[model samples]
Target: MSSRDDTDDLRRPFRHTGSWYKMGSRQSSVMDSSVQSLREGSVSVLFCVLIVALGPIQFGFTFSIFGSLSNVGAMVGALTSGQLSEFMGRKGSLMIAAIPNILGWLAISFANDSSFLFMGRLLEGFGVGIISYVVPVYIAEIAPQNMRGGLGSVNQLSITIGIMLVYLLGLFVNWETLAVLGALPCIILIPGLFFIPESPRWLAKMGMTEEFETSLQVLRGFDMDIVVEANEIKRSVASTSKRVTVRLADLKRKRYWFPLMVGIGLLMLQQLSGINGVLFYSSIIFQSAGISSSNVATFGLGAIQVIATGIATWLVDRSGRRLLLIISSSSMTVSLILVAVAFYLKGNVPEDSHLYSDLGIISVVGLVTMVIGFSLGLGPIPWVIMSEILPINIKGLAGSVATLANWLCSFLITMTANLLLTWSSGGTFTVYAVVSAFTVAFAAIWVPETKGRTLEEIQSSFR
Candidate 1:
């Protein structure tokens, strides 16, 4: 080789700028970029995850609110979250959501009358309703495909953690103190948004090309080569941007209609399985089952849920989404059946009899198993799938529709749970059991495997 050719080969391995040594070869650069991108993506996703995750915590915390009233407020928010997200972008919408949450918690903390409590709950519900749709959508938009499912699972994990925190705190502190504590997450989240980049996909979709590349770079790492990924996002955005506006009529196409149906179906089954009802009146269920310490049992239930959801975060990407849902739904079906059987047996046995005591123990076991089954799969996976399956063109409107369906079902279940229990505990559980069984069939038949797929790839699968 010539002298200059030899020097060029050496330079190809390493480039020196001042005191810094940078990789010169494409292979080395790509490797380094991937590592740095992973790190940057982790940090960026962590903040986004923390901020949006708070919405679920808020959702769980506000479970103390009375009746279907909070659901009414949440329904209103769900319907409007799409417009808010479209107008202000994802980060801005979340910031706006945080304001109401903070204000709502503050109102609850100082409340002497029912009006303040009710109003506070309404505000809190509205905020979480927006969060329920936006956070998952934002996370899906920003996350690298490999990390998306795991990060998306964090939303549900945060919710389980929030529920446990409130339940634990309720054991020690006054309601006012708990309300103050509830506001703290949003207080932290509002300023944290300034540190994180806006969703690059959102920026690209809005035609802010320079900002889109910049945000994507920030997310992928300053030193990383984001050109390939950037182009992919731009292409995805460009394909949808031609339409400019998404209307309900566009949903008539099979590609749009199928995914929308999947999103709405999973959410509908999620509520119809009676999770909220079980959670809302867990104490009553335990008491009726003859548990001496219903509070302790409730606390245990929260602990189990948190632990199971945490395990799910680790498993989601590795195991994929559909398998977990099937397992979760099937197990929940069995557990609910066990609960129903226990309830039926308890009703038949005399209170003073040994059989009654045995039935009580069986009921507790069944309830705990039901919770474990739920946390294992159904609780987190549907949201992950919903966020994954929707095309960017219709994400805002379809997300709103799916979320509205979720809250609507939640309202119906919550409203009827107590009455159903009054009529027959065995019957209520049997109904939930049947619904859980149907979930298994639904997941097996329709839900797609989304692991290791890009957003564009996922959308393409439907077509």
Candidate 2:
């Protein structure tokens, strides 16, 4: 093995003057030329690294912006998502949404420079923003009252599954290949949209009576009696439509305000609980928890979330929304408190001591428990509740507001989490625990159970 002196000697750049005085003329010339070549080579390498480090755009802060552009796009898309869905039918909106997603992925895949990559991310974000709102509303409107909770829960389950799939694929594939794959689902969706039934409620609201009935019949089966459900949808839509067009002031009404508050509050709190920050920095968290294989632990966390969300899907309809939310939030509070205490204790213990290792394990356990608790309720139910409770008249505009609040909170949390963690891991977890504890009370007192209730029935409860 080389000592520090030897390593330093090896690294020292070649120089001509001193050695050349004793060397043959030809050897001296050759040495001097080689040294010049090495100097130029080093400079060239640094220039290339600078270019790469600045990202394909090579502008100041562009690299950071590149990573966050998608979120910005998503926020814009969310702002308009309700309007787009209302303008076009659910199926139509989804088809339109898929176009940008496909194009975005293609742009990303073929990008030689940063502009295409940035544009692609923006487009993808926009498409996702629209889909996020429409998909859940469509599911809630189409599903049978008995099965609505389970089906609505699937929206979140599918999200967790997609996230897990991306993580797994990312392990082996290049980013370009992954981008191409990212577009595939959207591409397939374009054609599939043609065959699926449009949301019956949407059709009803549009006054496409024949199409609404047809769509409902298709979803419920021609053999099933559709009269009861059809009438209920018409009555709900008709009554809401007759009121003056909802303005910001109209939301002050209890019917409008209560459900909207609950929906937006839950969605915002979901983000405030710092789920994204935790997941985003899971690797760092695991390392701090004394896990040797942080990557595996991260993947394990994703898998656990997927499994827990799946269980939530199965339990949602049977157990009811409010109960699950209460349980989920309460469990999350406890888990986060455990994590906070562990982090606090770890700081006081010597790193080499047994107590340090035990504290680390406690942190790991607390984090896992928190993830499970989140997956069971906070992750999925808020969207379900949002879709269920909002009136059809204001759903597009109001739902957009709710969705926007969620994305905004998500951005804030993602941006600040690192700073908070840097300040104090224990303190960061303590803040999250407090938020989760508040969510428990919010869900219990304010959030309604929409399980086993028709859309009209659920909306009526808000009135």
Candidate 3:
């Protein structure tokens, strides 16, 4: 690594200095943040559309299909592509992942049965697996520290927005219409392929000095002042030892094992909070409670989720990471408790139809509280934390690992919810309430504040 002539770069901001952006399997000029985030934010919206819609589209008709397996599909994609991404660069890997959903759309559009729907969901999961890691790491690598949380969280916000879009659209259009809407995002990928730059981190790691320079320029919006930023990238890249290898056996090492457990535990706890059950089963819960108007429940839930998640996004950077987890988790735990009590009351009501004794009021309040608790914490924080702690090198693999746990936990939660309803309706609600209590303990003991930390700093903490 050469010491950059600071004076020269300061004077000639736009001149070519043969910096490192030039070395890669592909070539490109440096780009700016606005362009980068726009592309990333758009992709994030597409992912949201697919994820929220997949459950309703695939499992709405069938009880046994299980929505979380779609999450598992993402896990599988992450596992397969994790280390592969370190070699390929984030942009290339993400573009590759985007294609599966396109294929998934083809399958979904013509689907006639569970098999086809399942396969479509499976493919969509695979696409998420590939891209989820790439996104946060991309934002982390490119975004200035002051703006990291806001920018990193655009993915989560888009997802909430996407969920809002689908639920609203579902009312006006049929399942097929929503399914088609899921595929429309692929169109963005075509332009993304030509415009988006590779991870500058990856470029620097390989020491492709010339290519790095051009990539840096474009990444910085070709600003002559970008040299200082480019140099920061250079030092960050240079600081890490270049030789890297990953083996399954590496999982046993304390450094890897600890953070991996932390990451996955956060994922598991996120689902255990009962957030997803509320999201997927909102209308069902409402109807069972004799809470009139399924559309009202669904739309209300969507709107609150969007609003609460928006608040979360706004404060995620400022309010601090650990605080949100405590607040959100505590709220969810209480909400679930209210929900269980409501179910208990509903069960004992003279006809399971009793309109009064204040049971109905309690049940409705419980339902809304569940949505609020989830939107604020369980729904968004896990993704943000996962993105924060996992660096580019291990991102795909780590994300896959954590997300797999997330999906499996989700499947268990949903299945258990169904089975509990059969065995004892009140018991199912109580179980999650119990889990929520345990998660609070876990968050307090284990999860750290990640709000203001950079990807490197978070990684360093784990060590």
Candidate 4:
């Protein structure tokens, strides 16, 4: 084949411009093929990164052991998620995760004392920790490349929706009823697993060739020709199988470390920006800000997050990852600053004065805007980028490190938010605002635009 033909083949899957290119020479084709195969390892490594990349809200508070214990459980679960998925397969791991969630919720529902409540909360967090990683990875593997971003964003959108549901339902339901409600989703998921196919790449990696092909066929639709995609997955699995065992020393290399750094940095910074603090303690924050209906305001905040995240889902593929991140981070910085200023003014103004109520209004608007900013890019894009960028050989270890970092940051932020608010609300938001400002710079300088790029193309850019 002509050089042009070979080049076209390399570029076919990713039509957008990026850092890597291929020459038509046979030598280059061979090298490219090797890299392509490695990139294809994305199928197996996808869940690995997702596990590390998607540390989400195990909402923390001081109200009970529930707050800190859940995050502790999630940290533990995140640590184990990669191995569990590897040993049990994606479907098996999810089933394992669901059991804890169901039992935790039930335990919470019927709790007679703090011990049961704590146990249930911890179990619930453990289940969420595993599910957070596995579900996104599952979605990333199964989704068509063209639809990946939109579908990936759905993961965050669902989290926002769940938060909203909880806030909205808290008004009408007793805590016991809400706990029972929490169990229902997992209960429903248990049986639904039977209907879905396992990750084809995983099957391929495990040397279950026929099963891999069948799963791919089912996922892509029975009528579709999966021959090309199937071969790609097989090559990926084959190349990955031959790679040397990854070690801590391997991280010294730029190609190995850069993507991991990006993944960990984005996730850690995401939590440090105090999104969870705002979420877990929004009721108290609103009340202190002089809102008449703190519960209603909290619910509204959740609703806004859902709406913003939905918009993000629609825009992720269209606008690209880097752009959304920059926009999102910038908006968050400004919104946080606005909040800090409002809170500062609240201290200086008299409660009965017009300025105090105006400051409250400003605080509300700023808080809402910050949540919107987060849901748009900071919330979902980190997972998508991590799934796309991490090198396959180091995926598991790197993923675990990243997941641990995220959950750790989440624990620290959520655990301390109430104290910080009491210490000085203005000071708390000021810290978050500064972190958010740094995130804007980080997104602009470090985060790559993964939109419309194949995993191989993305990884190659790091080289």
Candidate 5:
């Protein structure tokens, strides 16, 4: 196991870029705290609905129209947003992202052909990717330090919920209906604009003291020691400036190279885990394994993903980063091997020959295990670790690089999975199996323990 040593909190002191009190004599506690009422507000509920409903419009019907474009767009968005949010600040970037989301739903619902659907999906994917990148940064910045992990996780949680909700809706609703539903979030986002504060850290750095304080109070309420936290924020931000912004020169520096490497590794392992093949095309994989039923296997795979992700949410914090990755990676490796073996066995048996096609049960077992293993380890860890460790100055750049790697890998894997399945039924899955085993070794040796460590501390570990 990698070293799991306790280290001092690595939060650098904050220094607001502009600390002038410019936002209406500092919003009163009542006004400032209003943003915190997201749970009670109709707009907030609508916001959740908007996010969750995107599944249908952006992701309905598996591999066909919505889901494919959505995934690609999101990858592009995540990579782009990583850079955009850093420079534009988290709030403005997120607000801008909402447009395409709304547009996508409209186009998909109204369009007549696959071309319109594809265009809409492309737009939706771009917006979704932005949300995935920006939301975590926003949430992490808003929450009090102790609550950051729990709250930041909601970003990913919303996505999982969104995906699952789309799957459930597909049980009955048509894609057209789902496309209309996806628009709900865009409309709701307009109202949410009135609330959900600009990230305090972002505002503060931009030199908006009053806005920063107001954003903080809105999210934190009166219970937290605002004065103390504000001061701490100042110190942290100040320390960051001393390190200088990331430049090409910084890239050449030996001190920062390890994190860059880790970033690449994180995204590489994420896609290499054989997750996309199972998620986007589990029904197909099931059919290949002699389980010809689409409806049953798709539902089963989705259920497995949900269950495994639920388990991962619980275990990730407790098990810590290193152990969870090792275990999850190892389990995924074994399960992939099983899947490949099963596929090979089926490939050898002539379809015309009467054989027990009931291996659906066995295929389900193998796939479920692999999915569970993925949920527990590489699925969540890559993003979490990357987000947790990357330094603030270059956080967006590094995240973009890593996420770009993920998208490329996903595209390659998905494309290859299809080509290989067509070219050699037994071979592509074998490659995926090898990839999974290699991921186990990567997690075991290269990845480090990041549990409970502050972002700066984790960054230092790579050094």
Candidate 6:
């Protein structure tokens, strides 16, 4: 093939229609089946994502909370979520998580002192921590293999939406009202969980044979034949059932360790890239860059993230995960370098100089580019890859560890960002730019192409 043809092949839309079974004669075109599959699965996946996304909103909104305490709370929640998922199942764990979310919001909404605010944020962090792990796992288990990447991308998309909402709302409302508004998703999710079926794979894993079949029917559509898919789940579950409780020592095996490394590494890279630092401190970054309307610029940053993440949902399954990550990290590296250069020049140029204005514009443009680059790839892909790669037996434990690493890195970046900024504005972003450069190399070398593969197929590749 010509070079152009190679490029076109890489960009070509994924052909898998997600039709798990042979459609009857009554079924229409391939488009119809694909649409039907998406329609049936979208409702459950989107609803679950919507509920879990509240956690990300709370995460973003932590900029308004006390220090790094919220992250500390998330660390605690991350450690606990795995056990809750195993004991209560995905749906029940999410339901239980909602109570803390609601109460946490209430505490923040009516805080009489710093103590209430701190406690509230900690509770909120804990709720989000559980949500971070469960939402993707649940979605991956229920979605059809063909559409899983697309559906899994929704978790990140919802998170961007949540963050954007909080950013916009914070402009007008007081902290208390914003806290009250934050409670709304948990309230909706608590009741909405009842309507959705438990994950079929989870049910099967637990030996609930009849419930597994029923849950699979609900997700796949009642009229559809589920025999093949049902058997696949049973076989996958049976294979792992012998080791229902995955111990830390099991991670010594390559099959378990490889995906775990991928998961933890991707998340660590995602956080170390300074996405959260840029997000939480965009207004300050803009102001320091000499933008008069820092709030508007921050809003624009949030908007870009939401739009780019939205685009990722459509592209993830189509363009494939690894390519996007490469593109994203490369773009981010360039953008961060641009931002660092702009800041470097800002300090050197006199305020009265004509070049100062040019530097400010460069800084703003570079910041916007960085946000777009992140939203397109780093923002969503790590979570998608994380959800895709881990085996069912080790998923709960490994996922928690990966998530904890993500939050811990986030805390370190957020806590030190201002100090670093104060030390040297250009140098701060230079460090992040170097990390972004490394991320490109990491994606090229370690990240696998997970598009058009079943969860089992993806996991088996690690062996």
- The numbered model that scores best in lDDT is 1
| TM per candidate | 0.92, 0.84, 0.80, 0.86, 0.80, 0.90
Candidate 5 has its poorest 10 consecutive residues by lDDT at 1-10
lDDT tens per residue, model 2, 1-463: 1244323423333222244335665776656655664454334322322221111110011112343566676688889989999998777877787788778878988999989998998887777778778777877777778767777777777667666665566667877887887776677667666656677788877777668777766665443445556767777777776677888888899889998899999999999999988887887899989999887787788789889998998999899999999999999999999999999999999999999999999999999999999999999899899999997788889999998888788778878888899999999999999999999999989998888888888778777
lDDT values of the candidates? 0.84, 0.77, 0.64, 0.76, 0.63, 0.81
Clash tally, candidates in order: 0, 0, 19, 1, 16, 0
Stretches > 4 Å off in candidate 2: 1-67
- Global local distance difference test of model 1: 0.84
Cα error of candidate 1 at position 423, Å: 1.2
Which digits, one per residue and each the tens of the lDDT, describe model 3 over residues 1-463?
Answer: 4335333333444444344355564334433434554455445433433332232222121112436656667667767666656767766666677778667766766899878888987887777666655565666665555556655666566666666676677778776666777766654654555565565667766766556666655554442335555665555555444426567787787657766777788888877766666666767777776667886777777788779877887877888767777788778778777877777777666754545546766777877887777777766677667767764445667766776677677766765665566676466677777877887777788777876665666666665
Number of the predicted model whose TM-score against the real structure is largest: 1
Q: Please, what are the lDDT tens digits per residue for candidate 1 over residues 169-189?
A: 888988899889999988888
lDDT of 5 by residue, 97-132 (tens): 888888887788899887888888888778877766
- lDDT leaderboard ranking: 1, 6, 2, 4, 3, 5
Locate the minimum summed-lDDT window of 10 residues in model 1: 11-20
Residues 282-365 of candidate 6: C-alpha lDDT, one tens digit per residue: 888998888898887788788888899889888988999999999999999999999999999888889988899889889889
lDDT of 4 by residue, 42-134 (tens): 343443323322222222112233667777878888888777877788789888988887888888889999899999878988887777667
As a whole number from 0 to 100, the lDDT of residue 248 in candidate 6 is 73
The alpha-carbon deviation from the true structure for residue 180 of candidate 6, after best TM-score superposition, in angstroms, is 1.0
